[model samples]
Target: METAALNPVELEIARNRLESISEEVGTALIQTSYSPNIKDRRDCSAGIYGPDGMLISQAEHIPLHLGLMPTMIKNALATYGADRLVEGDVLITNNPYLGGSHLPDMCVITPVFWQDELIAVVANMAHHVDVGGITPGSMATHATEIFQEGVRVPPVKLFSQGTLRQELLSVMLANIRTQDKTRGDIMAQVAANRLGERRIHELLEEWGAERFAQSTHALVGYAARRTRAAIEQLPDGTGTFTDSLEHDGNQQRDVAITVTVEVSGDELFVDFIATDDQVDGAVNCSWAVTEGCVAYVIKLLTDPTLPSNAGLMEPISVTTREGSLVAAKFPAPVANGNIQTSQRIVDALLGAFHEFAPEQVPAASSGSMSIMTIGGFDETTGQYFSYVETYGGGQGAMPDQDGASAIHTHMTNTRNTPCEVIEREYPLRVEAYQIAENTGGDGRYRGGDGLIRHLTLTRGKAQVVAGTSRVTTAPWGLAGGADGKPGSVIRHGPDGDEHRESMTRFEVQAGEGITIQTAGGGGYGSSPAAE
Candidate 1:
């Protein structure tokens, strides 16, 4: 596949240049987006792909987004062949069956052309605030079907021949609750892709197409070689483990997600056949998410610093039962799958890897994103509002150091919405935000502590929907370390009474409040029993 020979030094420079372009695209999306989900929380990702739909470089964004980006690109290419994609043409999609995490994560694809020859594809995925659903925030916990979650967008041309599809845009905006912000966020993604297109064209002009292709091929090969070397260091055996979701929200039953990782020679295989069948709730995930989770853990174990591209996944193979919870079929609600089940997949992978490489894998993180959404009307403004948030809990302890506290770990890498911003935007008051004491597991190096966020409604009625897990099964410890405390969502009524709830949707009257207590990381290393 070597079109032209390039030395190692030259290859490194080219790699950095491509990666820098992706980083710039990500920055453009964040700076231009209007929603706090994209702007403040930074729930977005950007990447550059080759003409054949292979990921070349990506920005340091959400792991779930980056890992599944290639699939998204390939699906577009397959639906509308490469010959159909011309300069100034862009594709938009959030179809869960076609390489999408959920409906809210809209992906924009633009083909970069130089001298009328297609050279690359620049794409980005951003979590829109709303896409028209029964729920206010579009994250319905009890959604039994995909249609109940949000609007479903297949791979379609949002822009064709340098012209905006105004009709298409208008229709999409008409369905969602937050039309203005959603429109801004979509255009922001377009802007990011356009910027990436210009940068790629400039790179091609500077180095010529042959040199650019040669350097990218060389860079991918280098990453593959590094990953293979890392894989060869591990023992040849199979490690199996099982972790679970306490409840799927549809029924009050535990859902187990199991994995068996096989490492042989320079190849690694991850199988998810031991998991439970897909439930009728919103926790089921598409196959793309399951594959992405496998690829993510392999990268974590082998060479996290290696170039994040398709080549790094060359030696890894994934297998999943078609109708399992981790690989759910069509029409299954997956609103919480991407955020909640994805975390449990990582935990299962870590559990398996701990069998042979305990030092390489950290103990379980707070095994949930702790999603909390409160939506209601602001009588002061006479407009409907939905406040959606995912809180960071404790990070699992490492063998050499203590875990980090109050941080987003694995799959999710988003910034927190400030207390001031939440209160300013919504009719809510920041009652108390503090670190929950005695939450982390005790060990030689204790796990990090979780946090508590208590918010009170200033006025009007509201509906609270929470999608969370790890309430019954605590984040497990390693090497005899103690287990961390379980997390819970508590409602403090107007009469001063409090109670715990799980995956629930209820009404909150004025003066009522809710408190979210996230879980802490499990400790690492053997220690005596705690008093």
Candidate 2:
């Protein structure tokens, strides 16, 4: 069938329509989810992919989740061949080795069919609060192996031929502590993907199969051309930088992450072969996450307005060592790696870019996600409760302006869980929530200030996990700027206040409280005082 060519106006319309569908899908997931992590913090992502598993459109959600969606879909298709997937078959998985960032992040994928032909796949990923791990949340700081993180779900059919797989769901829920919440969130993900499937079918019907395929092809090609053009603006050269994680839960030693970025003609190459080996802690990320970080930085530096799809990565190449921290092997604990190591990867890559494009790249941000999780049994409700959240810190200063205060940066784009929601859902109270005054680095354009959050166990005992970074090593500055302040976690109990490591898990009794202070951002230029 010959397809009609799309004019610029028609192409733009198609792009907006597809992007809007993804956004709508995300909104549905958020509104229907049962956990605070998904509904309140919006810790979820949605995207549409081609039949061959290439990303077509995505919601402006978490960068880490959005980047890894295509990989997850590809792995699912590989396991259950596209030819074998029926129209109503919905697949699910959260295996890091199988293209997932972590175990808690569950991926729900549904194939979209038109006229009995597989046209595309609509998918969404949501972070479940508890998935039956050693800790309250699945992101245990001391987890040394993948088995200890949470229940690992490989690519399998959650719904076949429009029927729910009750046995499969029962086996999954049996392992989770907060089974009701997890079950609700999982169904919400299914509903979101179903909505996406309907929207895609409507789009295909309106545009016709031939025109729809042609328009999508045109959209991807346009993104590729724009990305290549942006790369062409850069001078051909190679730049290198190294950054480190303060600790990996099990040890206080630093884990190094190194990157070398090469710009040639109209192409960009990123190499992480010099990075350190995977350690015994939970700070090692998989290759999918490494690719996500690289793609994020490239899109950020190149053209923020370009359509986000597989085409944007056409001019980019990323290479990582098989057993390195950026590309860990099986059995490696990777709960915190998804949140912490990914941030450091962005910092290192941006530092390397700063060497050549000093004017274009800003200084480093907080370089930490500052994740905290608390889980306990609620006597009043006769239910198990798990609370998980990532606090925002300082955003790095730009060349012409100051950094933003207490905001999610880089790979993470989630909002802070509201205090009311926290107190109502968990056996904890928000004692203090404010900005740490003067924590930002001083420069021509000062860096942003970090946040201070204090939470006290309201009743009974609870388990707490603090997974963070930027304690031993601070966010680096560019030009003549100064490094940002490091982060810290403290416990206030009957024995007085004790400091915690970058990644630690502990038990807190009633009346005891925990304080989390995130890291500040790096300054852009030297201050007058230093001059």
Candidate 3:
């Protein structure tokens, strides 16, 4: 038998170059971005893709963004052909229906060509504080439609033939809340994309564009095969689970999520046939976002060595009704559904797996995106700034041990921005940034605890927004283990009274302190191993 041979030395170097582009792009964005979200919080991802838009590599950034790149690339190519895309022309979009997670997550993609031939595309996506709509932060729980959610930009050319699109820039700046921050962030994305294009061209010159493209395809397929092998290990049947969100960010009813996961010889199928239809609030998620969430869950338990690509998803089939929470339909506000809905799905699936494979599954992790948004005047510069902080909590203890504390759910791989950086960047003062003691649910093998973040508006006024879950229905423990604690957001109100809101976006006076407590992870099986 003859074996196909690939140069191991050249392949490793090409892979390194592919991933390094993201690192460079991340560093450039962090250094130049005007908002604390990008600078301090690092809510961004960068990647390099083949001209076909198949993701070749990524910097270890947000798994959501990384996993969804191929879809976005496919959409872009469908809209703009390779011949139409030219040098220095950049494309931007944030339409979930087209291929986006939310209304606020702005994605910029630029194609790279060498000697008039397409080589690759440099892509980057970041969370903009505001993109214009009824809400200041572009994420209101009451959003009923895509228009109400925020400005939705189809795949438009932000730059064409190496020239800036002044009209689009002006319109974007006017529609958004913070003009300075939004404009600056947009430019930052352009620069990072340019950087990636340059690096990719250099790679093309170094390792012949055709050869590099072949290698990318090879790498992607390798990952797909590895993922299939991982899926083959399950009990070769089906597992079912159902989870719920307390409320859909409105006075709306609770949102339910259901999954019928099938495992066969070397493939997995996750069906959301029983999930509730689209609700009236922003708690709906687009199909692209649903794919990201499912991929995250599969990756956590499956082969970590697999490259996240279309090939990886080849053996995995995911189905959901267009209007369900998992596959939010068109015109439904899905800005919040990507985060909240997906988190619950993760918890539910993990819970279901616990019954059959107790050792493979543990208790649920913090069930929400412990998010905080603070925007107001800065006393020092007398300027305005908004600081958004996303915190994580613990994963549930296993059958034999305790849960790990202060880790984000599978939805994110980002770290909490240091309090020092937060205070230094914005006018807010960090009073208490510590772990919430005794907040974890009690079990023989106790679950992990959450965090307590206290922010004082030392400035005159601040508009604060919070998006957290497990505030009512706490993280539940499994198989004889105790439950995890619930989360909350409390504000010292006008009359010195404490006001708590489930998913709040309100104003705070000078004397107010916003205290946000994150949810803990659930606990696993019985007390402990028989001593």
Give the TM-scores of the predictions, in the order they appear: 0.97, 0.98, 0.94
Error of 3 at 419 (Å): 2.3
Alpha carbon lDDT at 49, candidate 3: 73
Q: For all the candidates, what are their Cα RMSDs to the real structure? A: 1.6, 1.3, 2.6
Report the alpha-carbon TM-score of model 2 versus the true structure.
Answer: 0.98
Q: lDDT per prediction?
A: 0.86, 0.89, 0.78
Off by over 4 Å in 3: 1-11, 376-384, 399-401, 529-531
| Candidate 3, residue 424: lDDT | 78
- What is the alpha-carbon lDDT of model 1 when measured against the actual structure? 0.86
What is the model-wide C-alpha lDDT for candidate 2?
0.89
Cα lDDT tens digits for candidate 1, 429-528: 8898888888998898889998899988888988888777777779988887778888888888856756655577777887888988889999988764
**For model 3, which pairs clash?**
393-407, 397-402, 397-403
Cα RMSD for predicted model 1: 1.6
Please write out the lDDT profile of model 3 over residues 1-531, one tens digit for every residue.
122245778556656767788789877887889887887778888887767777778777887777666787778777777668888899998878766788778989889888888877888899998887766677777777888977788888999999999999898877776779889998999998888888877777887766777777766776677788888776676778888987787763577898888777898888888999888888888777777777877777765666665567888898888778777778889767756777888887776665555567778778887677777656677655667667877677776778877777677766778888777766678889888777776777788989888888876777777778888878888877767888888887777756465676778877787888888877666555522
Off by over 4 Å in 2: 1-4
TM-score of 3: 0.94
